[model samples]
Each structure stands twice: as C-alpha cells, then as structure tokens.
Target: MTTDEDELYDADEDPYALALRSGRGPVYLRLVDGRRIRMPVHRWHEQPTVADKTVLERCIGPVLDVGCGPGRMCRALLSRGVFALGVDIAPRAVALTTAQGGLALRRSVFDRLPAERGWKTVLLIDGNIGIGGDPQGLLRRCGGLIAPTGCLVVEVELHDVEERYNARFENLQGQSGPFFPWARLGRRALNSIAADLALSVTDQWSSGDRCFATLAHQGSSFDCPDAGRR
Candidate 1:
C-alpha cells in the first residue's frame, strides 16, 4: 500500500523518524504561509488523557482511527474491548503502534482500507482532519467508509478559520522537509464543510483545550451528546 499521499518528509531523516528513534523532543509542521504547528510526538507514547477517554466513550461500534500516529487511541479502545484499528502512512508510526500492542497498518486513508462501509466510527482527531489538504474530499471518503448508521467523530481547531495549506515536516533545529498539502477546519468551518457533504452535526462538546463534534448524514437522527449550538 502507498504511504500517506501527503507525506513529504524524507524517510532517512524525517521529523517522525527522528522523534520515533530518539523517543523525545520536537516535531513541527511548517506551513507554506510561514506558520508552524507543533506536533507532540511524546504524547503518542503516553496514556490516554481525559479528552481521549471522552472521545473513546463516545465511539459507537467498530472504530477506525485514521492518521493514527503511534495508536494511543486505538490501544485505549481495545483495552475497553472495543474493536479498533489504527492506520498511518508512516512506517515508524505503524511500528510504534504495533510494538505497543495496538493493531495498526502502514497505509493511507485514501487507499483500500479494511471493512469498507462497515465501520461504526471513524476518528479524525489531532488535526488529522487536515490530512491531504482537502477537508471536503477526506470527509466524503470517510462518509463512504462508514456504515449507513455510522458516525464520524472529529476534533477540529478551536478557531473559526477554514483553509487549505501547504505544509511540511520540520524540527526544532530549523531543518525542514519538502512541502506537502494539508488543511485545517474549525467548528464553524466544519459545519460548512459537513453541510457541503450533506452531513449534520449531531452533537458537539469540549474538554479542556480540545473540541470535538460527532456527525451523521442529514435526516438520519441519532441521539448524540448534548446538542451544541449549530
């Protein structure tokens, strides 16, 4: 299977590889617009926090964790007897997840994934909604990947901006990798993106600094968490 289509880092010396090998320090996303987003590489090895547990508790059925770096969420779900699988484009990420006793595959979300249209929950957390730099396209794919009654559980930015961006991997030392495509969607922007794909925000909630929303196809009403203002 192909690695993540948006992966632009060199295998020999990518930020992910360095982080995985050293097991510490910084990895950053350098946006083409001269912005940098920090990625917490160490958190993948840490236990699930309240935000993670909240998301896990909200999951309905068989779960697919996309862009599952190091598989912390997947491992947590499995501990609760929930069938969860993690997929990532980084081989090191896959290895780390598996090494930690979590089930994971080194594959892209755009590729042929297992259990098509059978998953009950598809997770796009940790800014993973930004993958491929096309929120609508990715959401469309996730819509097709889930069962008719399934829902998408997503974590979005806290702001109100929605835009596609060119990004790349970088480290604290100022070294950078090739530019790739990415996107970001906040709750308001997410609403617009979801509506375009005919998805309805069933529920929304927040925990600490993170925000999450659950979605299902329009007109298919399902009891979600406390409804947040649309």
Candidate 2:
C-alpha cells in the first residue's frame, strides 16, 4: 500500500506542495525524440479544475480511479453519489481521500484490485497511464479492470506525437525517483495503442488543453482482454 516516499514526507507535507514552494517538483516526461513535457503536477493537489470536472461528467457507473493523487476526482464523484474508489501508493494520498469523505485505498494498480472486471468505468486521468512506465501494460490492465462493456476514460498528451521514455519523479528540492519506463500518446496514437492489445478506441474528446479517449474490447462480449495469458 504505502511506499518509501510516505516515510520521507510528513503527514501534512505533500510533494506537490513542496514543489510549489521550491518551483521544481513537476514531473517531466523526457521523450526519446529530445522533447520533454513538464506535467502540471501541482494541479492534482488543487480543487478539481474545470477540465477535470468535464472529464468527470462523462462517467456513467462505478468508477475506479487509478493513480488518484489526493483524490480530487474521487471527492467530486462522491458528491454526485457515484460509487467511486481512489487508489494510490502514497499513504498520505489515501488519507487525504478518506479525510474528504471519499473511498480510497493505498495500493498499486499492478496489485490485486477489488471487483476485477466488474467496474463500469476505469479512469486514467492526469496522465496516469504513465504509471509504472508501461503505458501498454497499464492500458491492458485497465482493460481487465472494467466490465466487458465498460469504458476506460484516459487523459492523454495533447500533442500529435507518440513517444516512450524513461521517467523519474522529481521535486523542487532536486530529489528524483528511480528511472522507469513511461510513455506519451496523443489522439493520433490511441488507436494504435489499443489495437495492439486487441482493444479499440470508441470516442475521443477534449476540454481546454486536456484530451481523453474511451476504450473498449473489440468484441461485443465481455472477457478479460489479457485473461489466460500474460
């Protein structure tokens, strides 16, 4: 559930906050093409922005928020009486979620999750698909987390390029995490990514600078996309 970073930061301290004071914690996605995109990490800690609310409005059923930091989206869903659960590896994030009257668990997406293949919607907002540095693997895992007809709403890069990179989480203090595989996919790349895993993109939308796509199994029936195989 909790990670080493939980021990590194105090109960009241958060990486985003620290980054704000020091001006450097924003996670950067360094592509192989010599292009690096700086993520708006601080936005995750603030109240749900208009763009985030627009994305939340698309949910139609029980939702699972992957890499839910501080649980802003979870809180918003709860206010709508929606059944939502936020999971993150950071203890403080889970605590913050529950503190705000939202359901949260300290866990990793790669680990066992509740109600596998049963959720109506699984969200990969805020560029969370980059978690664990394997976008394809994460998308495949999300394919199993949602119901056969369920939709996977993912927020992707707003560019027109697709790239994979080694990512690291760094703070204003210049502290950085270990290098991990990560990826950036724009609207043009969604179909290719989904088709690779036998999934398909059903819809694409944008709010402000944020872009999202809805994914589903290519077949009409419901079955774990990665079931019976690694």
Measured by TM-score, the strongest candidate is 1
TM-scores for the candidates: 0.88, 0.80
RMSD, model 2, all Cα superposed?
A: 7.0
- Evaluate model 1: give its TM-score: 0.88
Worst 10 residues of 1 by lDDT: 221-230
How well is each residue in 32-104 modelled by candidate 1, as lDDT tens digits? 8888788766666689888887788887658899988878999998998889999988777787788788999
Error of 2 at 56 (Å): 1.2
The lDDT of each candidate is 0.81, 0.74
lDDT of 2 by residue, 19-84 (tens): 222233456544445555676767876788988876677775589999887788988888888889
For residue 50, what is the lDDT in candidate 2?
Answer: 87
| Backbone clashes in model 2 | 1
Error of 1 at 40 (Å): 2.4
